[model samples]
Target: SRSLLKLLEAKALIELSNQTKPPQGWPSSPARNLEIPPNLNPDQANVLQLFQNQREQKEWLLWGVTGSGKTEIYLRCCIPELEAGRSVLMLTPEIGLIPQLLERCQRRFGNAVVPYHSALSEGERLATWRYCRSGSPCVVVGTRSAIFLPLPKLGLIVLDEEHDSSYKQEAPMPCYHTRDVARLRQQQEGCGILLGSATPCLETWLACQKPNNSIGLLHLPQRIAARPLPPVRVVDMRQELADGNRQLLSRPLLERLSGLAKRKQQAVVLVPRRGYSTFLSCRSCGQAVTCPHCDVSLTVHRNSDGHSWLRCHWCDHRDEIATNCGQCGSTAFKPFGAGTQKVLEQLELELEGIRLLRFDRDSTRGRDGHKQLLERFAAGEADVLVGTQMLAKGMDLPKVTLAAVLAADGLLHRPDLRAAEQSLQLLLQLAGRAGRGEQPGEVLVQTYDPDHRVIQHLIAGSYAEFLEEEAAVRRIARLAPYSRACLLRFAGPQASLTASAAATLLNHVANQLREADWLAIGPAPAPRARVAGLSRWQLLLQGPPASPIPLPSEQILRRLLPKGVHLAIDPDPMEL
Candidate 1:
């Protein structure tokens, strides 16, 4: 090795090596044989026509059902703008979707598609930035952070999956949402803005309802080829236990999986959480083992070799699994809930011939991990895929004949107002992943509260019905859509400082609220009361629709905040 190194060094000494540089400018060649689809559905055609003719419409919301051709519409809308010598910025919520989106865009626009995200190396990002500044028309697809890019002659902005909470940036000053920022940009540039989603955020829906509002709504109620939505079967866990069946897979789901495996089809099992067991609890003392850094219990995780550990979801802190109760020193502990790992293990045991693949945070840790796992599953390497909420994103897997929610009860009982709405959207989206091909699809949702509103809505497959009921409740309660709300969060290492700061802010806001139309909710603990060793508290303020109220200035508020306490202001946060 030393001789080889000496030889290589001597060879390099003859001439200094040249440093490689990133590619300059965009691709010169046009897209290779890119052609438009032969035809569009009537709903799709109508929406495209409206967008093309109404150049005056600054903001438009496209509410399409899952599996509907929203991306196609976005591509179609960009053609005219690109041809007119204008650029387009398209945003999605996840980095996992970037590769697929980039591929689609490249097929049509070729090298004009520049991807902007944190994952890009500094040189790559700088090159893309320089290329965008060259006054040439191109398409950029990226996550929320892409909204800040300086694209000259920007003609159109598209926010695909706009309802996703990932669009919101919580950290840093001037916290804002991409959808809102897109609207602001549309106003400034006189460019068309399009927000597409299967489940529209309530605020956007309400804006569309306003008679004088500038936002317009376009609906695509049918999937391509008029394929019927998969039939959803709601399985009551209580009945399953009563019938002497105690397993992650409900009876219907297990039967469907067996059938799929026999027929050489694929399936996806979704669990909202990622660890093996949700948490460990002492059977003797009935006390749950909680995280040292956070208020929540530590989840149980297992490796391929079967060693178990406790991990906090919020802080990513890990520790050894407790063999005995910490408080009473009793050697009686049990797992209380299930996550992706547990479901994966159960499926391996229950379905003998099934080739199972786990697709969660742990399994997808390496670079390009998501793409590899998805491709493996897509290639029919796995008979069933088990994962978390990441599986519900806009993944187009056609061979998946079955999709199952191992536990829907966990999603239904969140402390947030959008719980039911989110739950419905997740179920519908997961179900939509199946039956995309010639074979019909089936969905099985197992939940303790089978009669819950979210479960019932999923079973009925009626988003409008669910939204109407939720809207009425929000109206009566003066929640979002009926009013405007903001969350002020304070977190610090010291609990007293966090609490006191939160209380002081709450009182300050309360004193400013003279009219009954404005209200302040609390200076109470945040839903995630403590995370990463920081104690958290929050205060929520709500104002009536169309009402302007005076409040503390950002500068004054920051100066008044206690030292060591960090403040984050989220306007219209998806969660409280």
Candidate 2:
């Protein structure tokens, strides 16, 4: 009876025992005057036809190049579903992308477009949940969390930028990926699912290649109206240094930014980090300032009122920067590495009277922070928008003629297997932001290693070629897309205790799975040894290609580990 009441409250089941009259009918459907866009290109039109013909297909991948009118294809596919009185759920990887996408969906579908994301207030989310439960046909545009929304008569699910790591929930319990959940929903609701991306993850690409796989493949090879992808020019930082130029902005990139005002165009500058500097180091001892709580260096953050402090990006720990080094008691200190704030400061100093806007997490805060900054940039309030990786995701700005990446080496030199692939994806996605309009766009990538594989692929604009090569390497090494992995993380106040607990749990699982295809990899310290004062250790369970690893139940795991130690099991973890 309690469960029945709960279902009634969620509008999933209506009670008729106490009703004297018939229940009221559902609310009136919104007016459907969908503003259909111009005709789709041949590639997109072909995908639409394929989608229509394969009604029994449960999943499809739309592998389209950037600026190839993928969004138009999405709109076209949804039109028929909406007309059939079914609902469409559109998912984006980031909340920052919601505003632009929401505006477009609303413009096209009118009041039938429902915007849902974590950024919305609790009350707003509750109202949306209720509305979707009303069983009315509508389109819901949101981020990864939107996968959980209940849609009656769900006809389709669309995941844009499916390659992004944001779709994976790394923290908290019950870790999962949005795409996996979407597939689960498809199985339950019998609806079609579409994954659209410019640079698809190796896993999805491989899945589509299987001979009898249910996932179909759709390709859009060219940009709409025959506009070319932006040409990328890699600037060797080593060469720039040899030429007596040590500025963060390369000579050519600076020259381009300098003429933005005269050329009457905008530019987007992407910096990997967000603070004024990556870390503060002692000149004498060469020791960087480290966070007390986290096992990482403290970043230098400067406020508008001429105040600076040290912050740990991992734990949000803040501390005052000491004048002297802790290790050597040296008075001389230097800030190392360029961040978004430093880039903005450099631009203000290099170009006179040039407007600049910082678009990173620090700059965008509160409920409407992202939308406000984006609107300002779109209105031409600033000539240059300096930001972090958020600038690389699915933003369509027609007037942006130049896109520049600062300190690209930071992105390339990550300690992850997918680093190169992700780097190329980010660079290409950022390049796509430019050249969407009338003028051809130019991309400048400043890196110490200009001939790096990722950089080379970026210059050639050969995403498929890069994927092919990368697949070979991954296949050889038995990495992801060829193997299955689950990460078991243990954290506690004491490092020794946490490590011992992790080791015990690993031994327990290994003994149980000794005869199975799964292989146990570690009981070692995590990549980040500690965070927010908790010592962390991890164990990885890997399986054969295309095989699922069966992990121990959470209850059994908790019982095995020490009482004070916390355990988190992540299936198909995106990050190590």
Candidate 3:
């Protein structure tokens, strides 16, 4: 029955195979009339020429700065492939980016452009699948899952914003990275692979530096129309406190908002978290409110009716707010950190008649939520757009003149190997959202630690220098680009049982590694030890540079673990 269903989904079998008179062909639409092309700048033309000159190269990297016409280059490269009766696949990091990209591609290629993502209905996905299998040349603008589409006569694959961690899937079984899959497909189909990014990942950067490497490199250092990069100013929050300003909005940021309103301009405010507050704490005993099913603090969320509750971010558990402290029976409680909701409230109180729209996960839940809110903002209906990291992913808003980060300390203090690199990429991308038009722009970052290396690099607008220093540091530590790592995760209902299972697996792996050049660490509790009533533990295996980590078969691994435990294997994990 399972095999039959698979065949049906793949369009290999019909409803009645015995009495078949051939199925009707799907309807096709004619392509729209092509519009006059925009004249390419010198840099963009040079990059396109490099691509044309190296048509046989399988791998290429397009390293361009923000607003440097990278998409123009992509569109120019697609014309020749489509004209030659071959297909093109353009992959973006987020679904929210699809609408704009789809619009652009359709404007140029008309009916040949197809959009695909997880939000589509089952019928829509099935139709798209059948269309791709029809052997007609077309272009697919989609997210990660679209990589599996059966694109016959595939000619080129483009990955935009390649440094984004969103390209890696971490849940369920068969954890995989889209970049790796693209490489495999390129080898099988003999297609060209182009990776375009403002800030490339360390692995890709290192790959392009090897002697006699096959991957070609291209660069675009200047922004379009000779616009200068926005000047970043770091605001010291400690000094603001010493001067007796107790509001969440720093004085400098407040003044800028007022100025923007007076000039009738737009601004984007980036908050690290989305709820009302980070967590609630008892004023008397200093005990933070926690989730019963998980080992992490519960964030406070407030609805429009002024009702508030506690929610566990990892497990989706909800509970009523506590009136009295569980530890000391105290009645006083306070929120420790501010989020998007709290920032919205503070902005309402400080400035009158200021139009604001929330752009985080909570607000954008409907089918057309992202498109609607973005259209409203772009049409000059909102003065300020408050959001999370979604606002930083290559959104080209021309009217936005001020970009502010409310809490830089939160992004800079993460406990991970690529924390600094990720933080810098995010901040730079956020800054790129501003100063994209005729008017000059400015960025204001609020941080307690003004001297942090991330902030210093952001202020200087020094991407190359930062990458060089970071590479040196990673080399000394023998981390990524220097070595490869694989993570083994274990989970069970009981902490002791999970630990025991992990220990057993660790012993098996240790014995295997005794004869190889590999390092084994763990059988320890994971960062968030418990989630959704399950205790979690992990083991890490590191292999030498450019070497593959040898893992046991799935059957062998399952037999090694206990009955009540679950195991997951992740290679090239985005997070440790």
Which predicted model would earn the best TM-score? Answer: 3
What would the per-residue lDDT of candidate 1 be over residues 1-576, giving only the tens digit for each residue?
767767878888544454434332235665578655558989899999998887777889999887888989999999998999999999989877777787788788877788887777777787777777887898998889889788879999999888888898887656788987887787787888899988887778878888886789989998888887899888888999999998777878777787776787899999989988988998888999998989999999998899999998888888997677988999989997888888878878877878999988889876667878998999989998999888888888889888898878889898888988888888888988988877888888888998898888888888878888889999899787788788888889888999988887766667677554678878888888999899999988888775654477877777768888998888777787
- lDDT for 309 in candidate 3 is 92
Task: Give model 2's TM-score versus the native structure.
Answer: 0.94
Task: Tell me the lDDT of candidate 2.
Answer: 0.88
User: Each candidate's root-mean-square deviation in Å?
Assistant: 3.5, 5.7, 4.6
Query: Which residue runs of candidate 1 sit more than 4 Å off their true CA positions?
Result: 1-31, 507-509, 515-517, 546-549
Give the TM-score of each candidate: 0.93, 0.94, 0.94
Output the better candidate (2/3) by TM-score: 3
lDDT digits (tens) for residues 285-335 of candidate 3: 999999999999999999989999999989899999978999999999998
The residue-level lDDT of candidate 1 at 178 comes to 91
Tens digit of lDDT per residue, candidate 2, span 250-339? 999989999898888999999999999999999998999999998999999998786989999999999998988889999999999988
Instruction: Output the TM-score of candidate 1.
Output: 0.93
- What RMSD value applies to candidate 1? 3.5
Ten consecutive residues with minimal summed lDDT in candidate 3?
18-27
Higher lDDT: candidate 1 or 2? 2
